[model samples]
Target: MKNLRNALLLKQLYQLKQLGYKYTSVTPYKEDEQHLRLPNTLDSLKKQAMECHLCELSKSRQKVVFGEGDPQADILFIGEGPGTMEDSSGKPFVGRSGELLTKMIENVLLISRSEVYITNIVKCRPPNNATPTPTQAHTCQPYLLKQIELIRPKIIVTLGVTAYHYLTGDDTEISKVRGTLHKQNDYTVIPTYHPSYLLRNPSAKKEVFEDLLKVKELMGK
Candidate 1:
């Protein structure tokens, strides 16, 4: 019976994804009230995130890079995990790649960096900037889901392969999925290369810009 129920929920989630209705959970927060008190505000959520130790990453992390930007923004930018700069600053997207991302938001989306929320799949930085293991992602996913629930952004731009994989549950390469508009549950998810990748490749900046243009168009709609 439990297995069957799980399967049905998964089916419904997939259907919602197809229909473009992005949200955190099919069941309301009330169902899990005993386990967690879902915060109605981003600040409260950040407080919870700062103390989280659900995974091993927490042990080595200097600080939890909770995320930043407008709590009520219409867009959310999710990346994989934090690197050295992010870990040190206890913020997301404050490094070189972050600077590039800022430019992307300003130049293409025509919005200030503060207009959209920015976060990562994991709150803590993985050691030496390695990819987060599935266990780590699974443990931290609830926090992100709750963030999505609270903010309820109209559009979510996933900024790399890891972010795309975590959000969409799709294992395809970013190259194939980039610039595509996918429906999660209420948000339209647009995947693109991480700014760090663009820094290395340089050539891919054009494609990232194109993806941002699509994001701008979607926002206007």
Candidate 2:
């Protein structure tokens, strides 16, 4: 029975990939024609992300925050895109939202924020905090996929509708997505509201915290 269920699950995942839902991107992050040595780890991803011209974002970007945190972390947090502070610092989630994320991370599993990898679906900061268009996402996605495959994280926590949408292609609302674990490309995925969202609506923290607890349980922490 377990084997049958597993087969069914694998079939569904393949269907999603075939339909351009969840996929493993193999393309380089850029077509620079000037190859930069990409590190096999997150640290190297940052270097490539900065020089990446996979999309027009590189043209106006101040910094392409590749990612940060423990490379071998069991947990990975993926966000929608970079914001002002992130761009300025060339780091992901360094603002108030990052602070909230840090606290939430600590609350779950006794792990510090520095102990888990944090990145975004799109590496570069979108113009004026705008959302990443489909074309941009297409260009940047391969890099993210590479990161996931390299880290082989045990859990992926997507923060916001955009990240969830691109990963699962299900237009389900964030409220519906949060607190429920989903599998994508063989990774355990759970979507939740962006920390920035929780800051605006503190009531949502309850929901975010609950989601964190789920991650804790999954980690056996």
Candidate 3:
């Protein structure tokens, strides 16, 4: 009974924290500082995201892979979606590819996982790690947009084609998209290679690193 009470109390606290009650920053599932307003906060917002059973990927998912990072972060990195590693771990990009991301983030921004916010276009892991469908993006785009509104990031880094297509509505190849900045609403969106792609084609890391350098310049960090 005590455990149940404590869990309820914690949920209440989280809701309170979400409603502009807290001023400090905090990470989603880690020990870091981030602003309190994020898309996963409002019950209506979460319900909208959770009600999405529009994709086949929803069947196999253990949890909806909503994003994580500083709500008030100056930068945001959007990827394809959770993989086997992220699905099992319930954390974004914590695999061999994640190591490359950590190195790139550190080399570029001088921060660890807890520093920047990370998330995906689709929260659930697609079976066999296939790409998320167009319908999935349609269903999830509003939530992503809401997140952007809540966070208000200055720079948005789209990791590879999946993210690019969702944010920019351009299905063109990533090679053409890399390093170009597109203004959406109030944010500047930058496209780049995903760490997993860099893992497959090591030579592309240089390009990804170069694109990330632009993010560093924007952040001034």
Candidate 4:
């Protein structure tokens, strides 16, 4: 189908973009070969990500921070990208913000942190803890997409405007949709404030609490 071919081309473009290629010509592929391009397993995907040098962030990163948690988790939390602590420790949400997130998960969701998966929009850390540029995010998106496909999480929580915007291609302010439920493909998406935001603006904690409650309700907790 033409639509399928176009979609396949788009995926290849993302891959090329990751490799820091500005432009390239794509040859048509037989449908059978299309599936072979993506790694079929999470381990393989993570391995691919670990060795990735597709974007500028890779130049400054200490580790890939590919993500961690139960392989078949029902919920996945996506943040913007690695911060100073995360960059140094090679883990997601391991800083002050991470501590808050852990408490939110355990206390509000009534689940252990290890029970769910956690990752970021981009695996590498941006210099000076700045937000990832559009090119950087676009390049790393394929990896995240593959992770979602392999993990097949039932719910995806997009933390902050960056995660929400990149995942849904919607630039709406996070406050307006913080606790809203959205159907995206086969998964339920819940947008909420990043824990780092809570650290700076503790007043927002109540709103995040409400959002987590919704997540709990959806999970039948």
Candidate 5:
């Protein structure tokens, strides 16, 4: 009986390992109960996200990047996930990619970075900055959804393939869809290459520039 119990325990642990969990904890409430407990307001929600432990990403993350910028902004920029600098500083888009994004906003859009909101699909950084697993993204989806509800931006610009995929549920290649506008309920979602991608392939800057032009035009009406 003892050996059988030990084998079962190992099986459970192995299952968790396969799911990308580095740690686990017992919670007092069910998943729905915990989710229902989340506050509605942005500030209150941010505080809750700071203390979030819904998934294993929380174990490795240095901080939970809730989001930043004008809550009432007409535009919201969504990225795939956090990176090294973001994890350390708890701010989205803060390194070279961040600088490029800032430039895009200021130069192309003719607005300051603070005029728009920025965040990631997943609040926490994945291990070694790997793409967030589906489970992790699913765990964080409610938070992002609530943020969208509160912010209610007129436009949502997805910064990469991952952001575009998760937000719109469209598996279309970003190259094929980039710069195209898709209506999501009330808001207009514009798919674009991430700033990080531009950093590696500077040639794509022109393409993103055109996309931003479309966003700017849409903002006018």
Candidate 6:
């Protein structure tokens, strides 16, 4: 009986390891509950983020764009990463693409940009605004995950394939996955084309608008 029990315990630990969870004194199952109980104020999270060096992106970042908007917002917009303008100002969504995003919020959602929280997969800008490598994103993913846990938004609108892939771990292209409603953790995720893509191909804006309307509908519920 003792040997059988020991074998079962080893199997349980192995299963936890396979699921990417570290068994500690506190146990892996309580990780989310513990994080939920932590101080989730934006100011506190931003202060910690300012000192973060979890990934190489931090080494080259001019500024860590932690994110900005209503802390208690029911909606969150996540982008790929900081752009040149956002890096310059230490804010998210302030460039040409940001302008488009703001317009969409106003025109489609009938809400001001300030009404929703906006952030990115990685807090720092990638070199020359390239897509963030998977390693960098994985290293910095905890912060975004914490933000989501705190905000507990009704809807999460992921702009671009990077954000979609980061949150859902789904490699589907944005063109293929856009407009589909996916459930991640405890929130509804809606993937759509990034504003930069819409800038290059204005025709895709119609599709993004359709996605945004879905966000509006979900938020209403």
Question: Would you list the rank order by lDDT, best first?
Answer: 4, 5, 1, 6, 2, 3
Candidate 1 weakest ten by summed lDDT: 1-10
User: Over 4 Å off in model 2, which ranges?
Assistant: 1-39
What overall lDDT, based on C-alpha atoms, would model 1 receive against the true structure?
0.84
Q: Which lDDT values do the candidates have, in the order given?
A: 0.84, 0.79, 0.74, 0.88, 0.87, 0.84
lDDT string for model 2 (1-221, tens) is: 12223323444455456689756554322323234234576666666667677567888888888888888778999998999999989889988999988988987658888889999988888899998877666566667777887888989999999998877778899987788899777679989999989989999988888888899888887
Query: Residue-wise lDDT of candidate 6 within 1-221, one digit each (tens)?
Result: 12223323444565556778775453322223433332457688788789877567788889999999998899999999999999989999997999999999999999999999999998999999999876667666767887887888988999999999989989998899999998877889999999999999999999999999999998773
- What is the TM-score (0 to 1) of candidate 6? 0.82
Error of 4 at 101 (Å): 0.4
RMSD of 6: 8.0
**What is the C-alpha lDDT profile of model 1 across 1-221, one tens digit per residue?**
12223323544565566789888656721233344554667888788789877568889999999889898889999999999989999989887899999999998898899999999998899998999877677667777888888889999999999999988899999999999999989999999999989899999999999998999888883
Model 5, runs deviating above 4 Å: 1-37
Ranked by TM-score, the better of candidates 2 and 3 is: 2
lDDT of 5: 0.87
Model 6 residue 24 distance off true place after TM-score fit, in angstroms: 21
Backbone clash total, candidate 2: 0
**Count of steric clashes across candidates, in order:** 4, 0, 5, 1, 0, 0
lDDT of 5 by residue, 1-221 (tens): 12223323444565578989888883322233343655768999899889988678889999888899999989999999999999999999999999999999999999999999999999999998898777677678778888898899999999999999989989999999999999998899999999999999999999999999999999883
Model 4 clash pairs?
18-54
**Cα RMSD (Å) between model 1 and the true structure?**
8.3
Better of 3 and 4 by TM-score: 4
After superposition on all CA atoms, what RMSD does each candidate show versus the true structure? 8.3, 8.8, 13.1, 4.6, 7.6, 8.0
Each candidate structure's TM-score, on Cα atoms with residue i matched to residue i, is 0.84, 0.81, 0.76, 0.85, 0.86, 0.82
TM-score of 1: 0.84
Task: Indicate the worst ten consecutive residues by lDDT in candidate 6.
Answer: 1-10
